[model samples]
Target: MSANQLNYSVSNAGAFSDFASVTEGMLKGKIFLKDGLQLTSMEVSLNHLPPKGEVPFYHKHQQNEELYIFLQGQGRIQVDGNEVDVHEGTSIRIAPDGVRALRNTSATQGLHFIVIQAKENSLTQWVETDGIILDQPVEWITRSSCLK
Candidate 1:
């Protein structure tokens, strides 16, 4: 294996002990860096947003695009001033230059989601370079829920 390659790895994303405070009432756990995975330049994280809270400000990535996969609760994501409702299983891919922000709109339900961010125009090589095989069936396995 190449020095940069990471063998198969797993993480229990629900354990919230180690979290970075994004804002008051909002926190995120960086899973990619924590796992030491060099598979992609992507940044992966699980974010928690309290009800009625929102991202502090609209922002845009100059070189990285972002994909948000909502896992629970209800929210609205505004991309370039266009708002769209989001719920469990909702996914949104935003261009690197698109201004974006998220808000937890549910009065009682907190929001939880995964965000994967990576540089624009950098993903195709995963297939061309055989970094990821496209034809194989995906494998699913469970990890212990309590990870310290």
Candidate 2:
């Protein structure tokens, strides 16, 4: 890796180059780079969203902290149970286990947001806070297990 800076203006990654097809990802950019940045230092990558782009099924993480900075188009963000508007210049974050989702709401434009996931094990650790279980089937399974 060369002793290079991550300033996109200086990097050769062409515009509309880092296309992230999936609904959501922790990072989106050229897979290999010369930054050699560390987790403590953190890194940034640009992202793309197709029309009607929606993030992965709502879920939470065990230890990861994430942030989304909207750079283009219009959209909506649902966090925990609150839905809010999103658009260029909107900044959002999901603390460790916060339930959140992003949805593109524009008709003629595609949504784009820069996402950064902080250093985390990325282990989907599941635990019911306040004995809450949203999945009724799973709740039933657990109750049956204890009775058996």
Candidate 3:
């Protein structure tokens, strides 16, 4: 068999406690994945906003576009002065120069979401062209085998 050749990093954000446990900065309730995962191409953050909470400031990026993916609760996001409601399963892509801010509007539930930032107009290939299908056998591993 070929030598195992793979590199990866895994972390549980919950190990740091609930998102709202952070009390020091504008990035409260947020955890950055880039530093922890040593990612080279993009920045990713997991966020949770307490009820009626907000992002604290409106900002724009110089060259990176952002994608926001909402996972729980409800909220609103303002882009370039226009506000739109968002909820679980909502996904939005904002261009580099679009001014943006967000808030959790739910009166009782917290908002959970993820944001991914990457260079604008940098994707030259997608799954169809960028991924290679290996001609290898498909083997299913049983849970019992994992313990051994």
- Positional deviation of 40 in candidate 2, in angstroms? 5.0
What is the descending TM-score order? 3, 1, 2
TM-score each candidate. 0.68, 0.57, 0.86
Between candidates 2 and 3, which one is better according to TM-score? Answer: 3
Using TM-score as the yardstick, the better of models 1 and 2 is 1
Tens digits of per-residue lDDT, candidate 2, 1-148, equal 2233455323433354246542223533223222443334344555665677676678776766777788888999888889989898999877876898778787677777666766555534446533564655543456655421
User: What's the CA error at residue 92 for candidate 1, in Å?
Assistant: 0.5
Error of 2 at 111 (Å): 0.8
Candidate 1 yields a Cα-based lDDT of 0.72
Residue-by-residue lDDT tens digits, candidate 1, 37-145: 4445677776777778788788899898999999888999999989999999999999999999899898887787888888888867654576654797887656764
Indicate whether candidate 1 or candidate 3 has the larger lDDT. 3
- Residue-wise C-alpha lDDT for candidate 3, range 65-123, written one tens digit per residue: 99999999999999999999999999999999999999999999899998999999998
lDDT of 3 at 23: 53
Candidate 2 overall Cα lDDT vs. reference? 0.62
